[model samples]
Target: MGLRFLVVEGNTRGARQAHKQAYGLTLSESYAEVLQEIEGGAVCDIAFPADEGANLPDAAGLESYDGIVLTGSHLNIYDRTPDIVRQIDLMRAVYASRTPSFGSCWGLQVAAVAADGDVRQNPLGREVGFARKLTPTEAGRAHPLLEGRPAAYDAPAIHLDMVTALPGDCTVLAGNAVSPVQAAEIRQDGGVFWGVQYHPEFSLGELAAILERRTDILVREGFCRTPEDALAYTADLAALHRDPTRFDLAWRHGIDAEVLEPQRRTREIRNFVEHRVKTEKSARGRA
Candidate 1:
């Protein structure tokens, strides 16, 4: 049987609509596209736990999938609002179901909170665009999730909240100077989750859209001297996305093959499907 996967969108209805408007695709849609690209013949279903009245899969339903992916969001998990609470509940159910799971950005924060960890606004300020110099820990170097990752690398990212306290059953993987818990593996209640604070699923165009949306914030945060500068930077990112062969644009932004090459940029997501999802599916006779 072909692998079946579930994509849990962490964004609310409004945020998702905004994303669609700005990026031309909802976060979940982008995740589904990337998953299909990574594992052709794999099928994906999307769930919106953050939207009120949205139907979510129960434990049995969750267990039926070969793997689950949680997408990033604009909501703050620390707020404990109804929408946020619903996502937390769904994550707990995901854990109980023991399905192999992966998350990015807000997805990672949600998983952390559901597993008894904590998240807070980063004191060092928002780490936008690319997360730089992500060095793997000893555990990460040996971890399968980062099997093909270099000693130090960069990935597409944009977030202000970070995991402040880790769960008891989690192991820190890779971290950078900005955030100490960039990547981790959490094992709880027979379930395994591999997550990263960066967006391995994001395309350069998507990053440009996000930067465009947050132009004012980028300026206020001192990332750019003015909105025009921010827009100019995003234009360059979009241009590079249109044509990756633009070495001048790549050099201007100090970006390398790690962020420019699709395979290298999404290595973590591919690793999860191979090392966790496919491995477990085979062991369970579902392969």
Candidate 2:
């Protein structure tokens, strides 16, 4: 069987446009072409509403897919909407079924809330610039997905809220002074659940564009002082642009590098597999 990824899109219109513009995948196309080049067979389904607030597709509907990935959106999970509830329900069902699941910014927080945790407006407004330093826990160092990642790596941060506390048995994989729980992994559950505060799917230039476009809003909301400051803060952004190996080396020694390299690792697949095997076995027993 081939690996499949069930993508949970928050907003069909915005998500579709993002995929097309950033990854060059149009709404009309199966995510095959773009995903194959980026993640190969590791990616599968890309779920979305044919229109807004449509009923969520069923979980068994996605049985052919092996894993779940929740897309980021501007909406808060706590908002009262059928779509939010449906997405939350689907995520919880994925957990109950032990499906391998991963989430980005908003997706991460939503997953945490669905697992009996909490989400709130961060006391610290928006983390609009590059968070240059993130200290990993011992488990983080051992985590295959995070291992070989710099002791501290920079990520282009552009979120108003974050996962303040994680679900039970969830290990904080990466953190810093500003955000105590930047990355987390729940290994004790039947299906491993992983979430990152940063956008792993985004490249540096893309991240910059996001911050650039939202500068005024970020400032008005007190997420940052100014758009110019956020974008011109090269030290952090430059560090974020570093390749995984070099970034890790620089982070360990606190030395800077002239150029950064992109880091690509398939750790997500490993974590996804771990969850899938556990969930499949559990589902079989129940059957």
Candidate 3:
């Protein structure tokens, strides 16, 4: 039988213009779509708009699922909004039930908070587009999530809030100059959670769409010389992924290394599925 998984999307109910243009999907829907690509063989289901009117599964309901995925959000972890609070409550339940969970971006912050960690608005400002070369920690070097990850490489990212402190039991996996806690593994209430501050589930096409949606802001934040320049920057990322011989093209857009390696970008997501979730199925069969 296939593994059962649940996707708890952090976005609110309303759809965004950018998402509509990119895939005609609601924010939560798009997240589910990408997650489907990573946990490919699993039977996946989604719980949407976790903040409002969300019907979070009870403990028994959670146990039925082999894995749970938490998607990124615009909500700030420190905001204490009712919706954010609900997500926290859900995270707590995940631990109490010992459910295996994984997360990205806002998803990571929520896990950290629920696990007794701390979060704050990044004083370094928003890390838009991509986070580069998040070097693995000594622990990450041997971590299952970094099973085939390079020592360091870039991944799609866009976030403002970050984890400032982690639960005592949490092991930091990777970090870089931009974000101190780029990824972490947590153990709490008998549950295991793996999370990343970047979006391994995002495709470069999605990243470019996100950049286009935030074009004006990218210019205002001085991330680009102009709105047109922001568009060009997105195009560069696409180019890197498109051509095999364009290894040198990355430097022009601040992307280092020989070329854009798709595997490098999706290192964590594949590892999580192949190692963590699938491993559970094998263990269950043995039992």
Candidate 4:
């Protein structure tokens, strides 16, 4: 059987913009890569609540998955909308269950807020495009997932708000000058939980589309004066994408190392199981 995973996507925006506006990786390519890895011989299912307005899958229904993953979104967790509230509860349930959960971008904020942390817009504003360095703390240096990683790592980032304070039990995993909390993990015995502020899921093409789609917002926010400037910025990213090795050198954790393939693969398996768990029981009832 395939691994079961419960993927909690924030809303339709997360689904629609994940590739073009967020990670910069094509949805089909990213989803296919993940499905191929997690499915292996078993089934893998990626679930979303449709929109912020849609109801979440029941907690009982989510309990069967091996792990869970949270996707980034345009919505803010601080909002009182029913959909945002539902997502917060979903994240809370995942944490309370001690389920292995991974979060990216907005996913990181969701995890932080659900765990009693704080998030706010950085004084530096939007950090769209790229980061050439992510300096891990001493604690991060000792971490299993981060050990052997470099003192500085480069990754693509896009966000206005940054996680400012972490919960009591969480350990920071990565950071940079603009955002102090780049990634983190909860302290638990034999449990898995991690969150990254950047989008490791994005490829260059996907990132450019996001910049293009949000051109007006960027201009209004003073991120760029004109479309041409935005295009130039995105173009630089495309060059790095074409030759990842140049930028890979700066990312501390050896995200490009062959050794980490095992860890990445393990994450894929866990995610697969978690996604499947959320849907397995429903499928069985029909059987």
Q: Each model's TM-score? A: 0.98, 0.73, 0.90, 0.74
Question: RMSD, each candidate, Å?
Answer: 1.0, 5.6, 2.4, 6.4
Candidate 4 Cα errors over 4 Å, as ranges: 13-32, 35-42, 50-55, 187-192, 235-287
- Candidate 1 lDDT at 268 equals 94
Worst 10 residues of 3 by lDDT: 256-265
Q: What's the residue-level lDDT of 26 in candidate 2?
A: 41
Q: Per-residue lDDT of 106-126 in model 3, one digit per residue for the tens?
A: 888999999889999889998
Best by lDDT: 1
Report the Cα lDDT for residue 83, model 2: 62
Which structure is stronger by TM-score: 3 or 4?
3
Indicate the residue-level lDDT of 156 in model 4.
52
Ranking by lDDT: 1, 3, 4, 2
Candidate 3 error regions (>4 Å):
15-18, 49-51, 238-251, 254-261
Candidate closest to the true structure, highest TM-score: 1
Candidate 2's residue-wise lDDT over 1-287, tens digit each? Answer: 44566677655576568646743554223323323445545646566543555655565755556667776666776674766776677777777766667777777887887776777777866675555576788888887557556677766456778776667867888888778887887643465678777665554545544555565776688655877765464334444555435565456434343113333322333344454434654676599
TM value for model 1? 0.98
Clashes per candidate (backbone, < 3 Å): 0, 4, 0, 24
Candidate 4 residue 100 C-alpha distance from true site, Å: 0.5
Task: Quantify all predictions' global Cα lDDT against the true fold.
Answer: 0.95, 0.61, 0.80, 0.63
